[model samples]
Structure formats: C-alpha cells, structure tokens
Target: METNGTELRISGVLGRLEAVLERENSLIGTDARFDITASNAQKSRCLYELNLLMKSMEPSDLPRAAGDRLIRLRSVVETNATRVKAHMEAVRDVTDLINEAVQAAEADGTYSMDTFRPAAQ
Candidate 1:
C-alpha cells in the first residue's frame, strides 16, 4: 500500500489529538493547578487539521489501521468531553448554591426583633 501525504498528515493529526484527549482526561479532578487552555488550543488545532485532511481524502480510501485509529481517537475525545461537561455541571451547582446562600444571608440581615415586629395593630 502506497502512503500518501494526506494519509500521513491525517495519522499525525490523530496521534496528536489522541495525546491531547488523554492529557485532558488525566487532568480532570486530578489537581488544582491543571489548566486546560493550552490543551484546548492544541485540540482545536488538531481538529482543524483533521477536518482539512478528511475533506481531502475519500473515506473508503483510508487505510484500515488509520480508520481504526480514527475511531479510537474519536471515542476518547467524546469520553473526555463528557467528563468535562460533568465537571462543569458540578462547579455550576456549587456556585449556584453559594450564590443562594449569599442572597439569603443578605436578605436575612442581622435579624433584629424590631425589624420583624408588625406595625402597631
């Protein structure tokens, strides 16, 4: 089988993408210093390269191994996406709870009996 530039490029992109997905997955809930901005940038670049490569190649022409790798990479990306989404939801729920507590505290004030006393009936 003859290897073409497009096939090679696609494989390279997939490799990089897989690494990024693995890193992102590992970072989830691991430490306080894990930042996703750089990983996200790399992921975006890999996806852009992959999209361009896919557009240039016919799906039927891709090597079987390359196709399999693509499927695996896709699965990893999807799983990591779900993990990130779940983490975001947890953070949002905590934030909402904190905000509610703050609002309640602000509304409650120092709780003086005079403030609650009804006007002379």
Candidate 2:
C-alpha cells in the first residue's frame, strides 16, 4: 500500500511523541511533589490523543463516529475527576474531625495517642 507524504509526516510526529512520553516514565505513583503530576500527565495525554484523532479525520467523517467517541471520552474523564474529588473531600473531612477531637482532648491537659485508640475486645 502507498501513502501520501503528508500522512506519513503526521504518523511520524505522533509516533515520536508517544515514544518520548513512554520514556519519561510515570510521575504519579509515589512522587513527593506538591502537585499531582501523574494525573496531569494522564490528562494531557488524553487531550492530546483526542486532538490528534480529530485532526487526522476527514471533515465528513467527523459527524458520527469521532464526535461520539470524543463525547464519551470527555464524559468519562469528568466523572472520574468528580469521584476523585468527592473521595478526597471525604477524607479531608474525616481528618478534620480527628484533629478537632485531638485538640479538644489536649485542651483538658490529659490528651494522648492512647485516647484515640480503639478499645480492646
């Protein structure tokens, strides 16, 4: 099979980008960064792939298949972000409660880690 020069160039560009990203390794798992670098990288890759896919498609082909896929991908990303935010919020709330309890116990001048421990069975 033969391909146009422009298509080959586009494919080459995407291939090189993917290779570079793969070599960089994950920045998410156990990094001590103040920011969530891994999540940001994943989000960036998703957006970049979507852009490349849309840009590569013919104008006439964009109405049905690609449009639907883009919609679904965006919806999934949004849902995941919401769920993660909700979970983090819940954890923060629990932590605040624990800190408050500890402070209250400390105010009485008898607070200790033992006070927060579960009772023996």
Candidate 3:
C-alpha cells in the first residue's frame, strides 16, 4: 500500500537496529550498531522501519531545523518535526477563522469589509 511520494527518512539508530535483527546485516561499530546482510533485505527492512517510525511520530509545536549547515544535520529532525506541527496548527487556525467569518457573512446577508473585519484591536 504505497501512499504519496516518498519523503520519509527514519533515524540512523533505528536503521542499525533493524540491521541487527538479522545476524548478517549489522555493522561493526563494535556495538550492536553493525550487522552484515544482503543489500536487498537491508534496504527493505530500512524502508519498513522508516515507515513504522514516521507513522508513529507526531510533529512538534514549533517548526524549525536545528542544524542547517552543521557537519551532520543531526538536530534538523526535531526541528522538522516541530515545524510540521506548527504548520498544521497554523493552517487549522486560518481555516477556522475563515469559516467563522463566512458564517457571519451568510447570517448577515452582507459581505461588507466594515462589518467583517473580525473585530481588530
């Protein structure tokens, strides 16, 4: 069941963890992070882990990428998460305000800017 265009990437830790599931795929960072396995199986397992994680993750309240030009974009993940959440919330608020304003306009049978200014400060 393929969804939209693929834009998901799971953490490296999870990738190595998946590799460890098989005796042959994990790398040898001298830790459980190294496993050796066939290329195809490794790829498939990685895709699966990424899917599992992405589906489970919830975006954060604020949106940003922590490291834009660092050696490794290690912190961008959380920032991306936060940004996703903030974008969703912001869109929701806009939609709700528009709906409310539309309802008000309908009820009054007039679309005058003076009356539909939304009670500005």
Candidate 4:
C-alpha cells in the first residue's frame, strides 16, 4: 500500500514523541544533572503537534504502521509516567524532610514550661 502524506506526517510526529519520551525516561533515574524543563517542553510540543494531526484524521484512516507506532508510543509513555511519579515522590520526600528540619530548628522552645505546668484550680 502506498503511504500518503498524512501517514508520513503521523509517523514523523509519533517518532518525535517516542524519542522525547525515551530520552526523558533515560534521564529520570540518572545521577547526572539534566534540564528536565527543556525535556518536558519538547515532549509537550511533540504531543501538541501530534494531537493536532490526529484531530484532522479519522481512526479508520490511520495507516497500519501508524497504529503500531501508537502502540509503541503508549508503552513508552506509560513507562515515563511511572518513572516521573517515582521521581516526584522522591522530591516530595526530600522536601518534607527539609521542612521538618527547618521547623525543628526554628522552634525556640520558649513555652516548654507550659506543657509541664498544671492548670490552676
């Protein structure tokens, strides 16, 4: 079957999105520092373009290769989601620890005797 221009465009968008997600996934658990903002921006841009392209076509018009690519993209996206969730949870844990430490440090214990004192009759 001959590939149409729309099919080619869909394939291109899918490939770009897949690449971005794969790259983001690779950097998720790495020790080395990277710009997550840029990665996310790229991924969002790709998704936006893909959404526009998909809205112009019907599901029945999708090429076989495009369908396969979508399946693969779905798997990559799911994995990326899991990794991102874990990363966010780790950040939250660190933030909680830091906040606890700051609060502890800021406590002057000026009212320490209040807890020990009994109510006056």
lDDT of each: 0.83, 0.55, 0.46, 0.84
> Candidate 2: lDDT of 59?
58
For candidate 4, give the lDDT of residue 25. 93
- Top of the candidates by lDDT: 4
RMSD of each: 5.1, 10.8, 19.6, 6.0
Tens-digit per-residue lDDT, 15-54, candidate 4: 8888888988998879558677888999889889889877
The clash numbers for all candidates, in the given order, read 0, 0, 12, 0
Rank by lDDT, highest first: 4, 1, 2, 3
43 Cα displacement, candidate 3 (Å)? 15
- Runs of candidate 1 with Cα error greater than 4 angstroms are 110-121
Clashing pairs in 2: none
Question: Where does model 3 exceed 4 Å of error?
Answer: 1-74, 111-121
34-106, model 2: which lDDT tens digit per residue? Answer: 2445555755775586476557667554444334544554555555566556656876999999999989978
Instruction: Give lDDT tens digits, candidate 1, residues 26-115.
Output: 887686687877878999999998887777567787877789997777789789989889878988999999999888876777555667
| TM-score for each predicted model, relative to the true structure | 0.79, 0.43, 0.33, 0.82
Model 1 worst lDDT run, 10 consecutive residues: 1-10
After superposing candidate 2 on the true structure, give the runs of residues whose Cα lies further than 4 Å from its correct spot: 1-37, 48-64, 111-121
Candidate 4 — what's its lDDT?
0.84
